[model samples]
Target: MNPALIERLQAVDRQAESMGRGERSAYLKQQAAELGMSLATLYRKLEAVAVKPGRKRRSDAGKSELSLDEAKLISAVLMEAMRRNGKRLMAVRQAVEMLRANGKIEAARIDEETGEVLPLSESTIIRALREYKLHPDQLLQPDPVSRMKSEHPNHCWQIDPSLCVLYYLPRHGKDTGLRVMKEEEFYKNKPKNVVKIEQDRVWRYTGTDHASGTIAVRYYFGGETSANLCDFFIYMMQAKQDTLKDPFRGVPRMVMLDPGSANTSAAFKNLCKSLDVHVQINRPGNPRAKGQVEKANDIVETAFESGLRFTEVNDIDQLNGLAERWMRYYNGTQIHSRHGMTRYQAWNKIKAEQLILPPPADYCRELAVSAPKEAKVSPDLEIRFGGRVYSVKDIKGVLVGQKLLVAKNPWETDGARVATFDADGHETWVAVPQVVFDEMGFRADAAVIGEEYKAPSHTESQQHAKELDKLAMDAETLEQAAAKRKGKAVPFGGELDPYKHQEDTLAARNTLYIERSGQQMDYNRMEVAEQVLSKVEMAKLLKPRIEAAGGDWKQAVALITKQYPDGVAASQLEAVFNQLKTAGRLKLHKTA
Candidate 1:
């Protein structure tokens, strides 16, 4: 049945015809040599041909003769070609040579393209030559064509689950909550949830914008189970509008996916409806369609985050912060020669050159929420640098009763400030210079011992150092104070009785709150002792007979600064206009 096998058979026949009379062994040996066949193959071929009644010689075997119709079928095909071209054509010659090579009939012609084979030598070819027909001048060949390419971002995306784990928790009696923390023999001995969700190593849903090369990557850090899949799909669904310039624009045309519940859900389809992205499941065990994204996962999980050592992180907030920073860096700065530019650059540069994806008309759009109000800051202004707000017992000090500036730190932007603190631990009426905070010292940083240390404010540090100079506390007390201050909490109010120790309380509360009740206080008493600036509930204004300058805090503070270390008394009328800015509003350029 194989064409090569037929050629070998024909070759064997040619060699056999050259054999002398009664030279069966010589013929077999010649076949073994010429065809480079073993003795077994030669014997098999000889046996196949020698199928005369039972051990008849191959030459004496009675062959199943061809019928008149079959012989004529072959002859007609050959004869028709000959009549058309006198066997001078290449196809005709090849046909005749093929017939002769197989001993169908002895075909021969003067080394011509088309060979005329008379059927005198073999009835098979002679009968076919009698009527066989074919148009021998025709030729056919195939042409090459170009393949199609994707046109735009999100043309295709790929998703997969890379790892999985399982865990079990033994059930415990409900009395676990009745115990106290200090009473427990060991924290590990406490009973927890009876069932623990199986965690995967790290599953990623990475959406890559094919045209721009931008990516939205998220990790499955929790129960990457069915429930998590639902959440992931929901979030991805919401991303449809956020990611596109037009919510009605095209979605990821194709999603090449691996076998993962997160990727296979109808819920996912419902979400994709907002953008109309489609899904394409990969063949079982075939990951070729997602090779690029898989490679990207490797870079992120292993090479970028860390080197294959899957260390657990503390929290999601931290992870998101890190991811945000990395995304900003990757999109705006990282240059990739393959994509012709950075992701952001590509997104901006690509135009009609990009592949166009027709969006679904019914695709819904999502509007982003309004941005939070931003607080303007003076370049040198001071403010807190964290997000949590705290409640405090009112501590009397410089911040009490007086109007103060409340603005965000330009560099930190974590929290707004009600007032600024002086170098000394006192709350003073001065603008804060938002210095770059690199406070590496810890409250109990043992390694930070022996150095001349500074606490949060210059005043506290100088006072503490003074104590150190006075040698009041031995190394033991030094260690204790060092432990408390070094740990970062400038504590006060709740534990320390503010009424009994107002100065110390003010020193600890970091922030200064003004008192509303009327009171009289010394100008520098905030640093010296308990002092509360009182609020002016109502005031009557009258035009002065003499020429007077306008009201401005800076002009006043600058004039006060002229009295350096002994500024003019807070009670003096020459206190450089002690009045608020007109309209109780601020103009940043003038302030700056």
Candidate 2:
């Protein structure tokens, strides 16, 4: 309400109060005519101008009839019934009813007047759920996001892969040409056509420097796969040959991406590890964590891919060529909204040390998919990998016979890196140079046998072994101990019986085998004399014959038992059972 209008309405109300009741209606009508409104509008304006007290709240206005625990139970039931996409499949009323009926929740209320217990209404339950923030809508919302920043260009890069919606490359003889995915042919209804062109559908991989917003887009055939992701990542890192046009190339300190299969693939992770790049995979369904690259994807679709409809392209190479030109032009010319400068200009602020260049494309491709291999350190303190011996003696904590993870060093051609874990289980890499041999086929550092003698330094294990020997032999020097023993000393002073338990277990096993063999021999002797058949065996043999002869099995069993007081022999029981069944003395009892 306007202050001046409110003041005028208040003055009118005061003047009406001073007038008699008969004169008040005419005065309000005259004021309404002057204000270009009806008498009812004037009265309504007066009511709006007047300060009214708020409605009286109940003693338990904010309190819920349903307890917090009951509301949570109702929420759990509804949330459990929700679809994975967060669509509520169960209504609040349905959930409350089901929970109450199943005794999972109780929100019973005592009627004050009637002194009867009553269950909470659905409305009350819903109000409580919302008030307690246990509703499905509130519980299913995405977590709040915090803004992320990169200190400098190449400090952090965000990468994402998306399927291109507009164009797919169709092979024309040996060449490929771009074609639009029309609704008539490549729609949901035309699944066969869609599948036929699945391999040709173009996938776009977009990367952006988080600080500078320099976008690098590349197109590949098929969907998002490890190979395509690696290729794009390598392209983003390796220095471009045409630096004048596109200078945005360097290995970022960290790469932010979603937890996509390709982004989190073992091959991709190995590559990132090899490049010394930190891989920051955001939580699933959290794309805003790498919003820069996600937005870059959209920009490419609108600013670059939108132009493809007006141009003709041959093959993926030509398409990539166009994309490269556009990327350079856009980054070099258009001012970024965040920094108020062109992306290339902001990126050029990168310090020399901050811009870490990548290895050649081929080497990087190898690094991307290659996992570190475990190689055991030789007695000579060297490890053999890729048919080359690399000395690992200088690496701290490296021991002979201990396996170390070895990978090709990206920075050095004839060197390899050894991976070792620290106390905190974080991986650290130590570069090891390949061993070079002189003309004598020996290591260059090896001592000349006739000219000089060089005793190898004792390793930690050797030192520890010496200390162990001193304690075990009770001698200050190993030589003194050897001489004192004279090769006749018994280890542990012959007191410890290392094999006593083994011998005891073997004797017990032998005794068990002997008992088992004796029992088996007795059983075999009984079988040779024809073992007596049990009641079950007699019935099994007689059942088929009795059924064929229509004889009663009970009567047959009685006759067998009377003839052979002891159980009949297995060989003779079958013949006796057949005779009884054939004698017609064991007929099945007929029903009345």
Candidate 3:
């Protein structure tokens, strides 16, 4: 009747069915015996259980509804059906989709990774649209939009990088990490964009100005980094400086960049500061945030769409010149769509627009945040502060467990918490002692519990071991003679008398072994218990505290032998020592 009882019967039946003979009846009997019930009782419980179906329905990918408004309208229709029928989640979903398609809504399915909207499955779209209560007209038709004007040339230069088709395509070779990338795992891009040399691959960099419709495309023959981005900024600044007439001598104070590897680097940040350029991090992963640059990228890509091919373009000087020429052609000569004038003429429309310039340079520098806290050094060459990774200079007093200050800025209101390094990286435990453990919890009477054993150290325990062992052996032999003298024969013919067996004198040696070995818990058997004490693990554990004196793991092993005199063997000690050394751990050295 209970789930557990039912499962046991089923297991028995299964085991019976898997056997060679038709032992169904035997399984039923066995299960009944275990449950203390008859076979008929088990059969009654099984009748209430039902078998489930295994077929699965395939999912559609298209969107039936287009806009939010259209989806809502369709949802109203589907919701009405579900309310009338009181349907399930799946049934309601199906009804909504059916009505979405009936309304003839147009919507596209999109891929998250690629950001490409595609024509979707009609049925799937219909289902999704109906759930939203979409309307056909709302999605099928929409109006046009207006555009804004730019004020002057070089006023706003938008920058972004798109891996050309070649950059995304599969290539044959080991990756920079020396790992081989298979075709599927590798990026699929235009083959012409990424040029490969004898061993390395290179990338291209491009920039576009909003006002002049000028596009500057430079080939950056390497992967993205802050350094590469710094170079781009330097080149653009120098070019702007060279082209300036006697009147316009200033740099482009505000430069916009879409979020990319080359854009958000530390080197780029440093370069921007030195050049007095304002740096703004774009809304991450959102391309629409940099709409102007997005459009410029589209135009530049369209121009080179025809002639772009695979060529080992190594000369950056020539590449930059061509990019400048392309910008000139697009900006000075290309006719504007909104205005019949060229880009220069079109920019004049916004030339009268007001400026929102930055404050004085001195103020921005003063308002800047402080950097991360550095590791503190003492005169004795010890790291006084929390030991964490610090800049490798003339470090003094540095210790392994020191914690470092990780502050947002040195000027932040709250001081930073101490951070320490684990195998992963620097981490600080936010919880203070009150959370769980306390140093005071370790002792009851201001006496160090087992840790501070002033009475007798392990070596001293070994010194008294021979005397203790002889007394223990004598007591054990006396107990055995007393047990034999008593009329307690081997219990009902070799049947065990657990209590008297424990009183056996020979077991005294084993009990002493357990006590002296410092292992509080008894293992399943005496031999197994001894074997555990005789293992490499315990020896290896002592290796560290011993080798802290030096790299000789043998010294650590020797300290354990002195303390645990007759305990673990030399072979096991050597084995553990080699294991630590091979694993790059220095064994501890302990003075006996």
Evaluate model 1: give its TM-score. 0.28
lDDT, candidate 1, equals 0.44
lDDT of each: 0.44, 0.84, 0.48
Model 2 local distance difference test score: 0.84
| Predicted structure 3: clash tally | 50
Residue 72 of model 3 has an lDDT of: 68
- Per TM-score, the best of the predicted structures is 2
Winner by lDDT? 2
lDDT of 1 by residue, 434-502 (tens): 333336623232235587564433333345675773353232465665665566534441355547778
Model 2, 1-592: lDDT tens digits are 7888888888998899889988998998999999899888888888878766799989988988788888888888888888878888999988877877898877878889999999878787878889999988789887887887789999998888898867999864665678778987788577798788888889999999999999999999869999999999999988776887688988888888888888899889888878878888898877678877878998999999998998889889999999989988999999999999999999999999998989989999888768889999998999999889999878876789999888878898877888877789867677888999989789998888799988866788888888887666667798966765787676555677989999999888886434443343444434346688776677787777776666676777788777766667878865886578566665564434
Worst 10 residues of 3 by lDDT: 428-437
Q: Report the lDDT tens digits of candidate 3 across residue range 1-592.
A: 6788667656665666567655767766777787787778777754544333586764643433256764565455554554323452334345445654686543456778998876556565565555554533233333343554445655666667654433322234433221222345343463442233312443556665566554556556446665556555555444242342111112354567776766866556544443345566676655555577677667766765333343333344554555566665666677876556766455434432322233233322322223234445322222322232223112222343444433321222222223333466523222111112247643232346577654422233344654454353443454553454364544333544668766776667665434454557966764433244453567556556446645675644555555555556544755655555544334434557
- Model 2 Cα shift for residue 575 (angstroms): 73
Any residue pairs clashing in model 2, and if so which? Answer: 552-586
Please give the distance, in angstroms, between residue 500's alpha carbon in candidate 2 and its true position after superposition.
27
Worst lDDT run of 10 residues, candidate 2, spans 513-522
Q: What RMSD value applies to candidate 1? A: 40.8
